[model samples]
Target: MSSDAPVDARAPGQKTFFGHPRALSTLFLTEMWERFSFYGMRAILVLYLTASVAEDGLGISESTANAVYGTYNAMVYLMALPGGWVADRLLGARRSVLWGGVVIAAGHYVMAIPARWSVFAGMTLIVLGTGLLKPNISTMVGGLYDRDSPRRDAGFSIFYMGINLGAFIAPLITGFLGEKVNWHLGFGAAAIGMTFGVLQYVLGRRNLGDTGDRPADPLLGADRRRALTRIGVAVLVLLLVLAVLAVADLFTVNTVVNSLTIATVVITIGYFARIITDREISSTERSRMKAYLWLFVFAAAFWLIYDQAGSVLNLFAADRTDRDVLGFTFPASWLQSVNPILIIIGAPLAALLWLRLGHRVSTPVKFAVGLVLNGLSFVLMAAAAQAAVGGDLVSPWWLVAVYAIQVAGELSLSPVGLSATTKLAPVKYASQMMGLWFLATAVGDAVGGQVARLAETWPEPTYFLAFGLASVALGLGAVMFTRHISRLMAGIH
Candidate 1:
């Protein structure tokens, strides 16, 4: 839920869904379809990029395509910072979500048009729309329950299920249409999913009571005018810069991606500096922020490998994995579903394990566990790549096992990292710390995309093995400093 949004009293005799707010069902379906559109497009993005031009594909080089995928993911996460601001100060969460869904639907519809430029244009729109929609909707979910309600965590758990469910189902639908039939048709399917989400969200608003009905902090007349003017000027300046780059013949896709990647890293560093140097915060708060920096590095490292599943591993599934079952071959993108399904199955079990263990395990230790497991996943992938080196297709089970390991790593670190971010944040920078946490992902994806370029020049097995070992070494190093990080945490679990 939004930190600034006012929580309102529930209406008397309000209807409930499974003893929770009736509005949860609405938000649940909204997020489900949004993710359906997102993952559905993602599952086939690289495959579509590298497919033969004769098959109506882009035919871009594999390394460039992988970089494009990474950069796109980075932009989506990066935008969330501005997205949250728009909701808090201008449109409010409800309107931001509504408009965001509309734009996302429009993006998918644009992709469904079979022109060469539509793909890039559609992706740009999707990135902007997702930025607006993603964070605010989660904030709205938080608004549904009081800060101290026991049901709050459970509500988020149910919401988490919605996310994984969409991810698990999207590739099966979109992958089949994109690979076996027309790619545009698959994109059309995603557009339809988001449309359903928007329609349902609109119709279900009555159940929401006062949630996100207005901005948390609306600007006054003169201030609003000034803010709007500044926004316009900023947009114009950005456009002018792009035009200059284009005129200079420096506006190629790779150039844009490289610029954005560098910008993401620079912004992350600046944000950290701004927070840690703030005179408003206490020494203890500063110490916690210092510890958070280490966890941020670890989180970035983890995502650098985990997110490659859609690019490097997707290509592997297509080219090297034998997907034949009972004489029927499957779409390679279907393999993307494996990770989400495993996440769905493992999440409850993980929660149980953590509950049973409680604070006996420290945050840094769990992070080490995650990093080591993530590294082991890639180490296993090295063996799979080696098996395919002789032009033999390896069994599909190799990819399944790989996703299982990655999911375990995700369960160990991702939620724990979010919890740690909240616990360690200075009071002055509490909400902003969440944005910093997301920046970790943006940084990882940006750097990882650049790193992926080496795959084109290096042997596949060597690429996997080297990174795998590096991550393992980082994990072991984190273990060595666990005591120090715990002390820096200053009573935070």
Candidate 2:
């Protein structure tokens, strides 16, 4: 696991392609099944919430459902902070992933139970579990190779493809089952997928070896003790606040959950600030870290638009799109797969395009391009929304086209941002810095949900326009700062 050790860039029994380790397959399958479970649950969650009570749903209003969707998705990303912390400081990524899988499995099983209370409890557990698993698993992937290893980017691409493969399939299966048969059955299937992921990780332990274990630094133990103590105090204070809010009738369960989530976000931001501003970090590294923080904020805008595939877009598919195809109708839920489908097809082409333009574009320029494309996708959707006026169902092709454009944007930004973070993060705090990167994603998700909720208060066209214009503006701003940011990443890569 030493940085100098040569990677086994081959299939288990075949020749290597692009110098990536064969052990990547183990990580790939594990992530694939985990995403299958996650996306499957996501495809059905909004529909389940807004469907009729007679159908065993929450029967919430559209705005409320979107709010719930936004909050849940936000919490999922926010949890990654603690998940990474636990992995880096206490349990190590391997054990944390194992335990996270267990928690997620249990949560999904709870969702499969036939009660409103079960739904609440199950979703909470799943959010917490995801926080623990997502960041740690990603950190482990970076661990598998040395810094600036030529294979790193390609390995991440292959790994991301696995994520899309699971995502592409999940919505089709879960969406159909949830809409056509029973919602809980779809959740049950998701739980089963998680079980498979857990099993794969357990069986593939040797492939990971000591890559994700605790660092050998003697100071590591003291840091872990301090972190755990702070976490414990925070949890206690959160519980006390929840109790007070409930007694005052100012907090339903959802309100308490939202407050805790917001608190977690604030605390995480404070933690990163403390680390970056500390005198211990060299001045040069501090400048690079500041650049990373800026990139994170810009990347958050991309996620805000992209993640709508699960929340606002899901609702649009269910309510406004033409689901009928050749005399057979497809479930609106299945449309959620469109983004991943496009990603699977467009990723290679996007990669080639980047290679061709390597000398012409900086990472920030590519990110700006991504943001603009993502913004345009929403504008296209806005046009579709206008066409769907007077209760008409717009052609499904419109949704497909939007997802295709959005995927193109994703290819330009998401993977590149990940690479940039690792390269720029100081070696001593790499895992924690990556955790902050994921936290930006959490913030974007929360903001997306809020945007969706606000849009729910307006006409469809207005909502689309708002999101589209804001995304374009964000992209333009990022491009303006590209030169300054590039200077910060100087000498890192």
- Per-candidate local distance difference test: 0.91, 0.81
Give the best candidate by TM-score: 1
For this target, which candidate reaches the highest lDDT against the unseen true structure?
1
For model 2 the TM-score comes to 0.90
Tens-place lDDT per residue, model 2, 1-493, is 4522434555366444345665577778889999999999999998998888898888877776776777788888888876776775577776777888899999999999978877778988998888878887776777777766777777888888899999989988888888889999999889999999999888877666566666323236677688778889999998897688778998774575466457656865787688788888888888898888778777888888888888888889888988887888888988888888888888899878877887578888888888999999999999999998889998888989998889889889987887787788877787567677777777777766666776677999888988898889889988899889888876653
Residue 242 accuracy (lDDT) in model 2: 69
TM for every model, in the order presented, reads 0.98, 0.90
lDDT of 1 by residue, 1-493 (tens): 5433433335577777667788888999999999999999999999998898998899988899989999999999999999888888899888999999999999999999998889889999999999899998998998888888888899899999999999999999999999999988899999999999999999998867678777888887998999899999999999999999999999999999999999999999999999999999999999999999999999999999999999999999999999889898999999999999999999999999999999999999999999999999999999999999988999989989989998999999999999999999999888778888989999989899888877778889999999988998999999999999988888888
RMSD per model, one decimal: 1.7, 3.0
Instruction: Name the regions of candidate 1 deviating beyond 4 angstroms.
Output: 1-12
The deviation in Å at residue 59 for candidate 2 is 0.9
